[model samples]
Target: MSNNVPTGAEFKEQLRAGAPKMGLFLNSHSPTVAEQLAHSGYDWLLVDTQHGPMDHEKLSNMLCAIASGGAKSMVRVAGYHDRGGIQQALDLGADGVLVPYINTAEEARQAVSCTRYPTAGTRSVYFPQRSMNKAGLLGYAGNANKNVIVALQVETAACIENMAEIAAVPGVDMLFLGQNDLCMSMGLYEKYEFPHMYTSPELQAATETLISEARKNNVILGLFLFGTTRVAEFLAKGFSFISVGNDLHHVLTQSAAYVQDLEKIAATEGKLWTRRPTALF
Candidate 1:
């Protein structure tokens, strides 16, 4: 684990100062796929364990794949109670961790502690378990206390209600807004075509409060958007860290649009139907 490289926490400090922090989410388990994503100009890459079938072995492999392209690697554990996933992710060399469905300050506190060392927090340690080189492990633990980035996802209406306390948590690096779920929680399911959730007066006010409190407490603000165009709005709103899209959605969108365009072309060209072999994963 002793690659002796700069940690994401260090990079975050620099990114928070007007430089945009952009990252991608990995839904696939292929190491080569993860490596390709890392080289795609993403500042960081996060493996999604919440929805992906990523075991410790596969995760460790993918982490190495992500680092191969020099991208900061992160993992989104199932939740705070998934200590196995959390600890394994850190030991596997994730630069940071993202905990989802966080609705309370107490949960935020717990998530933060899970990533830290014994004295500062309670993360189990074992070298050579995942991070291949003992050098990488030693370096990771030596700086883990000051280097691990803990980002808590603030999505629920209740989370918005408790934003101040969540933002005030000492070790919390960023308060990430999960807009898709947040919109659903706010009774606006699948409403991206309508008013932007981040721009709504109510959500905007709550976000502003969270950002102000986070800044006051020396924490950073983050926002996740399903649309790339939404990045500009978040940037204008003073968000430094952002996640735009994921592999599955990107692939599905492009495939769907291409098929639709081909179908229209066939209809106009007098082709009664199109035929192709179907492959299912």
Candidate 2:
């Protein structure tokens, strides 16, 4: 019930306590989608600029939309080398960042340092930026370092090999698993049948080992899925923070279901399904 004012630190606390934290992934650069999902009971929403066509201008708008609806915005920048995009995302008021393709502990260290101030990190300071304008310079600078979350995606064999060091990087809050990338990295792209992503025993062994390493460090572990049904599996595997699904997938699923219902209605009523408003008080 603590809305708008909660810090990413608090979110991490919940995660550390094994509490379930739910969020939706948004690839559409539309502020409308951000606004709607923000108020739709999601604890957090990620605007993925990494793989999406979202620009800074649109990202700012989307952040505003998320703010208006009182949901935390976690922006996924392309990569840690994407310093400009990362800075802009933080400037545009992202509550956190999901950095991708981090394959080494040094890279993870660099990514964490990028989010801090001088002596702590190399993040340049500028007052009255987009993220700072709402709260003024005093509060913004005071909280930026404490409030922003930095989650790294571990999707490579090298990353899994260095998972322990990666997890121990100071200020690196969480480590997320990218299913598609992990599968592809293991040379098993397009092979999702029966849950064994790669036939390579090494990949499976590495993934399991990495998960164990994450647990040992007391760092937050993240898992991504196309839907919530798989959450039980992740949860059982000791994952606390899981991204179950996203807007695009939700839209497709709903659209397909609607089409199927329409066909059923047409057969039963001998006509197309008609739209109607009804109250169910």
Cα-based TM-score, every candidate: 0.86, 0.89
Give me the runs in candidate 2 sitting further than 4 Å from their true place: 1-4, 190-195, 198-204, 270-281
- Highest lDDT among the candidates is held by which one? 2
Q: For each candidate, how many residue pairs have backbone atoms clashing (under 3 Å)?
A: 7, 0
Question: Per-residue lDDT tens digits of candidate 2, residues 142-260?
Answer: 77787788899988877887888888888887888887787777666554553677445755687687788877778787877887777887787777777778888788777777867
Candidate 1: minimum summed lDDT over ten consecutive residues — where?
A: 272-281
Stretches of candidate 1 off by over 4 Å are: 1-6, 130-138, 190-199, 260-281
- Estimate, for each residue in 92-180, the C-alpha lDDT of model 1 and write its tens digit: 87888999998888998899889888888888888676543644667757777777888888778888888888888878888888876
Clashes of 1: 7
